[model samples]
Target: MVKCFETGAYVLNGREIVKDDAEAQAKLASMLGQSADKEAAKQGTMAYGVIQAHNHAEQGGLLKLKFDSLTAHDITYVGIIQTARASGMEKFPMPFVMTNCHNSLCAVGGTINEDDHKFALSAAQKYGGIYVPTNLAVIHSYNREMMAKPGNMILGSDSHTRYGALGTMAIGEGGGELAKQLLGKTYDLAKPEVIAVYLTGKPQPGVGPQDVALQIIGNVYNNGYVKNKVMEFIGDGIQNLSVDYRNGIDVMTTETTCLSSIWETDDQVKEYFLIHGREGDYKTLKPEAVAYYDGLVYVDLSAIKPTIAMPFHPSNIYTIEEFKANAAEIINYIEVEGRKQFDVPNLDINLRSKLRNGAFMVDQGIIAGCSGGTFENLTDAADIMRGGSTGNGTFTMSVYPGSQPINIELVRNGAMETFMSAGVIVREAFCGPCFGAGDTPANQEFSIRHATRNFPNREGSKPTDGQISYVALMDARSIAATAINGGKLTAATEIDVNFTRPKYTFNKSIYDFRVFNGIGKETPETELLMGPNIKDWPAMPNLTEDILLKVITYITDPVTTTDELIPSGETSSYRSNPIRLAEFTLGRKDPQFVPNAKVLQKLEVAREHGENPVELDASLAAIYDKIKSIDPEKVVDPKEIGIGSAVFANMPGDGSAREQAASCQKVLGTWANFAKQYATKRYRSNLINWGMLPFEVSGDPVFDKDDYVYIPNIRSAVLSGQPEIPAYVIGDEVKAFTVKLGSLSKEEREVIAAGCLINYYKVK
Candidate 1:
């Protein structure tokens, strides 16, 4: 079980927790032999140390940090390098690794996937970077194996870029942030709060890291307990877990919506580096004598049960026991929620049909990606399924090692053979299954996976096509248990199997032979291998004097993820081409979003050419007339106002760090996003980087789809740092509302004014 503290607390000597209440200061002072200074105590945290080490700014609230290294998968590297190249970047400032894991399936888009791989290689050669070839490793796996050093900070363009268990503060951000680092620009941020993940008690034999992670995610995600803060792992319980186990728990921290994470390192961590042949990277890291955390999450490992994150989200969690007890009701609830979420007419999401003889049956089981493909998880899974048969039925299972080295270890230890004996297919080190690219189930079929997320469409079912599938997230152990039982939903603990914990030997030669490491050798004369699919970004226009925004899509969901904004799966093949990718934006969530935005975008295009929007589209005349009526004395010129679309969601940008979530919106002529609040800082930053205003509205603004809201002096207001922005929704009558752009740095404002980060760099 996981418990989040309502108030902040102080940790003494890394083990003792003192709640920060009235008498807590006195107790802290007595322990530390001095008056408790909260501000000074904050500096004693491991997170503060790592952040400050990378920070180039004057010691203050605002941080301008440069990471030790950078990483990106194929889905992101091409776009990131393109943005950086346009922004005048020559050679990479630091180590940059481009791994071809996401787009390894070359047949998906003809030559699109491999063309990107070729382009990434040429970029690595020309710009002095590293390129891990297809199936060599996933992004996080490669980084964890070689790049993550204690006290170092790495920034990657993929979410789940967490390597905190190795004592490295690795963050998953958008491509624009990587582009900034490529151009030697600092990552600007306000100093974030650090939360102590105080661990105690050892986990049960059958309970795995995913169980622990799901427990923490369930406790913190909905309540926003650890949102945008650093989860600093501390206390005696960390010693009970292996490095890989810690890593399994760490990578899933993205679900908690934390900014980044770091951990108290021990000799076990040092040994992990030693096994990976990077012993020199090891450094002992821990908090000082006394450190203050803004919040605390105390997890009792022994109390955690085999957990499951139900369909649609990683936070929709339940214990395997609880789920089994109420299987029918839970499936019904998921069906109802799925109906509301997909909302596609004629789509039948009949999850209850999966029940057979009071037992829930799944069609597939996948142990893949950064979280599940770790050596420890795979080896343990193999032990559980060593001799058991996965019966040749409709139920299928697959295991993808995180990296070639892990695969080699699995092979050497007979884990791979054990998996094959149990009728489990062993796959290459690909991130496909995790993000809807691989192992797509048939309509109405259910899959239980050990992947990072269970978001809608994550299992590759196209609800828009009336093809809906179900996915529930469980630990690899439970998935193995389920697989052995012919896909009957079962907990690993329920099966009495001896877990032969295997010691892994790293095969450094796999990467040494396959990976193209151009770290310091830059071939400037190299030409990038650009296919027809890869295209440069379109020229983005600067912010105009005033803005006219048409609400193209309005979503009332409590949270809207990036996957819904811009879908994953086969559509990801078009990621290099912004216009083509933009066509798919909101395609799954709102099929009409593109066509509607395009219609309004035509008027904007006409207005840009000195033609009145009303002249081009007579339908917008009444909207313009209503705008003029809001301020009858002031004359509104069509040319001065930039017309573009806006999207309103209850809470937008939750999952994924793919910049496409915002870039696709931008490419479709979106000017702003009106949300109750942004789910993550990365999403908001993506919007800012793409030159879209991330406007926060309190409660419901009463704006409907196809409504127009005109904001006069918008560009000036943003540049002038105006807090509250007044705008009028043009309907039967002009209705007024306020939207706030919460705290923009001077550079962020300038970037917005310049239209995008690329334009901002162009001006510089």
Candidate 2:
């Protein structure tokens, strides 16, 4: 259904794909000339203008920009403000906002949820930050309505911080990155590669922005097409899509593993800002005539169809049409893969069992989160469910509007009434379900959702506990169709319904009354509240002369995701408690990983205390004897070695922007990670933050489990700043291999040597 061209091609006008080498070059040259002609024809829309604005600023480049305005949701604000306070922040230099969306449910942590909300309110008053009380709006939705601006940069602690549809450049990073911004530290990085996401043609009917996004994600995610690159959306397609349509697609660029994104702006976007009462923020953006793109991704909107990603990955894509045609084969493949992931011998993998009569079936359908919770998506879903009941046989549906404004619109337009009449539950904005804390399914149940991911256990089932379930990603339209068919996986293409496009009337009054506006205010009287669950980072030591690592959990999969590293759902409550949360590291992937890692950690502690490594752990003595037999001169004293553990994965660090993946490993005394490659830049950053050495190993090494990999002068090697280092893996035989450290910033180097970013900051 999808065709990938080796040679770069351009869509001319929107219908023809220029693939011939000479024709492609000619088309590109013509397009460049047209751009120059347009620049001369218009007053704005030149890339040079945007660059000049930044150049005129005191500090150039995407600034370690301290926002004069700031906002965060409940799950992050408490920790963000607490970290700021610990780092000597007295008053808000920006308008910091705390919204209670993530923890709004208050189901997982008892009174702690309400306590966080109350603390946010008090902190707003005392520290001069904005506080939006509980259930006000989802974090991204509120920012879209009030905070985003053209040419301005916004950094959120949440991973879905995208505002490109509003002509704003926003980045979703770890809370520590946000804390650094609050404390006036520049978000340091070498300049990122810019990838042009050239769009053209109008999408076919029934194909929503989510469909287009999934298409692009399926094409780019596996091959790292745009990983760590800035995706600049440009082309004729910009005019074909509405503001909300573009927003839906823009938000999912995070799933493509790109670092940040921006779009070419037009009047529609300008009108959006003006309607929201921020016309002054509107500035059109376009690439220069001769602007260089490190790489290019060409997307034809018309070619995109209603798509679905099967369980376990967002990249496992197939069109709904193809899925219906090859149902049996697909079901069998899912079953086989499910057993591997679940590690169960006789687990039921046949979801086709739910296919009643001649229709494929599902247990639940969800339309929520930044991708699916838009007003148009929810309204259409409600329309499809107007007089239809999902039936009691296994099918259920729930709808969550992106924000309160959307909910109000739904109520005003009768969408809410339609949904309620159909027995569909309408929920307030909460991200728990998207991250696996809510709406858990029974074993072997299949769920179709419009949320962000479908990773194993991301839907909240404990596969290792024998409670296995799966999720499939689809657009809201298809999900509604499936629900209407009583859990059958029906494609929306088969449905005949008129979609009413409603003009969105944004209501700012809700935010005006409930949201605390702390812009241009500074207060120093804030006495920050410290929750018992919140604690400072533990002390970490510097790199030693020699390093020793045990293979705590060796995964041979092609890739290992952050979900596997520190999982979501109930485990999210322990994010602030590093030590307590560390117990779950690799818990699902390897049930014995925690104990195995802890045992290796004890040996490090023993060596630090000037004790013999052999005496500290009996297992080390056996490996030590084998190493000694190879080379007596290579024998190192216990004091000279720093014992830790490592895990081998084909590719690691995929999905989620959570830093706990690497932090949890650091807490468990993991010093290095051996992988063929890393999946995303954010996950790699997580590793750097935790001070773990992210090592790349090529081909198949002769090293086995319990083998000792010795690196001589490890501290000096890092201090000397070599890009690659040679090491010896000693087991039944000693084998030599090369490990690459990749590119590291000076600060990143120091952080690694000092053990972690937290230690670097504490010591600095």
Candidate 3:
């Protein structure tokens, strides 16, 4: 279904693909008046134009990016503001907005949810920040209406911080990166590879934007095709999609693992901005003719079909038609994987129970969040659900508009009434169910959703404690079809429903009245309120000349996500309390990880206080004796070698922009993470901020639990500013390996030597 080009090719004249050859060069010269290959020889990749523009904006130094405005939803903003306060922020340096969408329900924590909302309002008044009260909008929806500007850079704290379809280069990252922006620090990175997402053709009837997005995600996610690169959308297909349709596909680009995305803008996008009352912000963005791309993802939109991602991941995709043909085999695969979550003996993988009279079955349907909560998707879902009951057996359906404005539009257009007449519940905008904060299912129940992800525990299940549920990703149309069939998974193509593409009339009065906007103002006398639960970060130790670490938690998976490292739901409440949150580090993934890590931490504490490490932990004495027997003269001062813990994962730091993944380990006395590869740029930045060594190991070694790996001259190497360090894994056999620090800035190198980024800044 997909094909990849071997060498980088350019999309010439918007229809033909030209390989880097002479005939292609002659054709390019005839068409564009000059040869692109010759021009590329003079200048580097065609992608360099965008990079140079960004570079020149900061005068060729690191761009100290100050976002024009900022918006964050409930699940993230509280911790972001709290971290900024801890780092001595007097007021918001720029326009910062806090919206209460994720935790609006307030089910888990009592008054804490409302308390955070009130706190945000008060902070907006005391300091110079904006507060969008509860139920106003989802984060990205509000950003699209009010914040996005052409050729502008926006940084958000959520993972789906993409507004590329609206002509904005936005990036989502951890709260620490936002905190640095508040403290006036620059975002540093080497230039990234740029991939051209050349689009052509047009989608046939019935295929939605989710279909196109899933097609792209399935192609690029597995092989690291566009990992940590920039995806520049271009070509004639830009004219084929509407603004909302483009937004639907653009938001899911985070799943491709690209650093950020940008797209060519047109009159459709200009109309979108104009309707939202920001016509002045619209600007046409197009790549220079004969632009060079490091790689190209040529997408024929007409070929994309209605698709579904089975349980566990968004990338595990298959066409809905293909899946229906091989139902038994697919169910068997799910059954085998489902065993990892439950101990149900002789579990029936037969969703065939809902396949009454030859139709596949599902238990629930949801159309919500950035992907499905848009005005068009909701209206289409309402039309599908109109006058149709979801039936009483196992089927249920719910719909959440992306924002309050969208809800108002639905009500005005009578779409909300149509959905209510069909017994479909209309919910306020919230990201809860998408990330496991709400809509928990009964054990073994299967749900289909239009939300962003379907990771394990993402549907509000705790598999470790034995409560399990599964989620499958589908478009709103398929979800509605499944609901119509009383829990049977039916493709939308099999059902007849008329979709009305309603015109959107944005109401800016609601924002003007309810939302607080503060920009270019300073409030020096403002005092920050601190709740008892909010605490300062724990002190961290600097790097030592020699280091020893015990393997505390080891997983051999090909990739370990941030969700697995820190979890999502209940743990969010403790995000501001580092030490308290660290108590839950690996609690779900490995129950013994915290206790084991804490034991090693205590020994390091004892050694720091001039006590013998052997007295605190007698087990280390045996290892020390063996080391002494090997070389007595190599024995150094106890303080020179710091004792800590490490974990080994094949690839760590995927999914979510949560810094707690790395910070929790630092608070638990983890000095290093040995992984085959790091998943995202944000997670690697988190490790540097916490002073944890993100080490990479190649090949299979016999490194097991409780194995000791020794790194000699670690501190001197960091202080001496060497990029590469040699270390020995001391266990059953002596093995030598190399650990690279990648490219570290002067400040980043100092941060590693000082044991933590905060410590380095504080001492300096």
Candidate 4:
């Protein structure tokens, strides 16, 4: 279904693919009537043009990007704004939209979510920004409707912030990046390589965007084929799919771990802007005549089938046919994978027990969030359930529109009525289901969702509490099909239903009436609405000369996600409060992590003051003695060492762009993260922004849990451009090992030395 080119390929006129080999120059010259220039061809990609338009850096390779717009959700905006305020920002430098979608429910923490909404509104008025109230729209939906413009770059604090389908290059990052933009600082990065996603053929009838997306994710995710690169979509198939279909596929590009994405826009995209009453934002965007890509993912749309990402990961995919054929084995494998995520004894996943009568039975179905709640997906889902009924059994189904406008359209077109008649509960435009806030299933129940992720504990089940549920990701169509089958795990192709692909009529009145558009109109006198739960960031310490790091927790998971690092769901209410949120760091992965890290933090606190750390923590004296034993000639003093905690994971920071993943570690006195490799650039950036050492140790981590690592003159190594630093693990005797800090920009180096982005800005 998907073919990845082993070597670089060139796209001729956005349609034909010419493999780069011995005869590549000859083939290119024959087509172009001249000698082929690979360097010039590289600039012909749509991504290159977008970057050129937004890039402010004079230097080649390094990019200093200034985005046309910025966006953030409730859980992230407060922290971003607080950081910006502390950084001497008076007003927003660009158009910033703060949407309350993630914590919209306000169900977990009493009045905590609503207080943030009020704070966002006041901040919008005070700082000259835009604010969308709770349940109005998800972060991406609001941006896609009003802010997306052809050839423009948008930076968001949410991971799924891709608007490439509309010819806009959108990147999701941590809150620090957004804060930097607010302070008129450029987003620095290395120029990313562009990979051609050459699409051909029309999708089969029963296929949906999630099916295609899952197929692509499965092929590219594990191999890192498109990691930290741009996936430039091109080809004749662009005319076949609707704009919503393209958007559904584009937003999921975040799952491929690519930096950003862009599409070859056509009349369909133009019509999309026209329908949304933003025709002025429309522009013709296509790759140049000859565009070279680092690699190519050639997709035959017709070959794609209804696919599902099994429990625990978006990359763990299987076609419905293949899964049904080997139901027992596949279910058993998922249970086994679930068991591996946590060490809780008596953790009974029991997915195999749910498989009865040769069919896998599910407990719930959810069609919600940015990827699934688009007008086209919802309409098609409603069409599938028009005459069918979701029987009253152990199964239930719910649908959430992406935005208020989409909800209104669904209500006006009788789609909502159809869903209601089919016994499906329709919800507001909330991102709760996607991140485990709403629609939480009962213990051990299985849910099939069309949301973004299905990570472990993402279904709101605390495995540590002996409450474990499962979520498998499928397309909205198949979820509807499964609903009709009473959650029998039926694919859309197995059911005969005519998909009424309705034309979406955009309604801007909903946002016009509810959203606060304070852009370019600053009211500096407006007071911010603060809640008891909202607190400013705590003081962070600067990098010291010699450092001592205690490995508090060690995770052997192949990939540890941000969700596992800090968690999402209920803890989101505490995002604005750094101290409270840090308490939950690694709460599920390691319950002892907080207490253990705090012990080291106390020692660090004592050392920071006049008090001696060895006196406070008697065991630390032995650690300092071992550190001095490493270099008998060189005297090592415990008073001069900076004491802190660290965590060791094989490959950490996979899923979300939540800064809390790194910020929580910073809050808990974490000074370093030892990983074989980082899963995504955003995670590494978060670590650097929070002033943590993103150390990559090849092969086995020489240190174990609770072991101490001492690095002398660490501050000099960071500021003097030292990529590889010498360190010794403290055991019976100090053992030598080397850890490499990957390439850091001058500004990034300064940020680390200053302790964090906030502290770096403080001096400026």
| Leading candidate by lDDT | 1
Which lDDT value does model 1 have at 661?
Answer: 98
- The models' CA-based lDDT, in order, is 0.92, 0.75, 0.77, 0.91
List, residue by residue over 59-131, the lDDT tens digit for candidate 3: 5444434565666766667667766665676777777877787767766546666666766776776668878
State candidate 4's TM-score: 0.99
Off by over 4 Å in 2: 1-72, 77-96, 119-127, 344-346, 622-635
lDDT string for model 1 (246-355, tens) is 99999999999999999999999999989989999899999998899999999999899999999989899999999999999988898898888877898998988888
| Over 4 Å off, model 1 | none
Model 2, 414: alpha-carbon shift in Å? 0.9
Cα lDDT over the full model 1: 0.92
Candidate 2, residue 431: the lDDT equals 74
TM-score each candidate. 0.99, 0.91, 0.94, 0.99
lDDT (tens digit, per residue) of candidate 2 on 191-242: 5666667788898767888888888889988888788777777778789998
TM-score-sorted candidate list, best first:
4, 1, 3, 2
How close to the true structure is residue 451 of candidate 3, measured as C-alpha lDDT?
Answer: 89
Residue 348 displacement in candidate 1 (angstroms): 1.6
Report per-prediction Cα RMSD to one decimal: 1.1, 3.7, 2.7, 1.0
Question: Which scores higher on lDDT, 2 or 4?
Answer: 4
Residue 746 local lDDT, model 3:
70
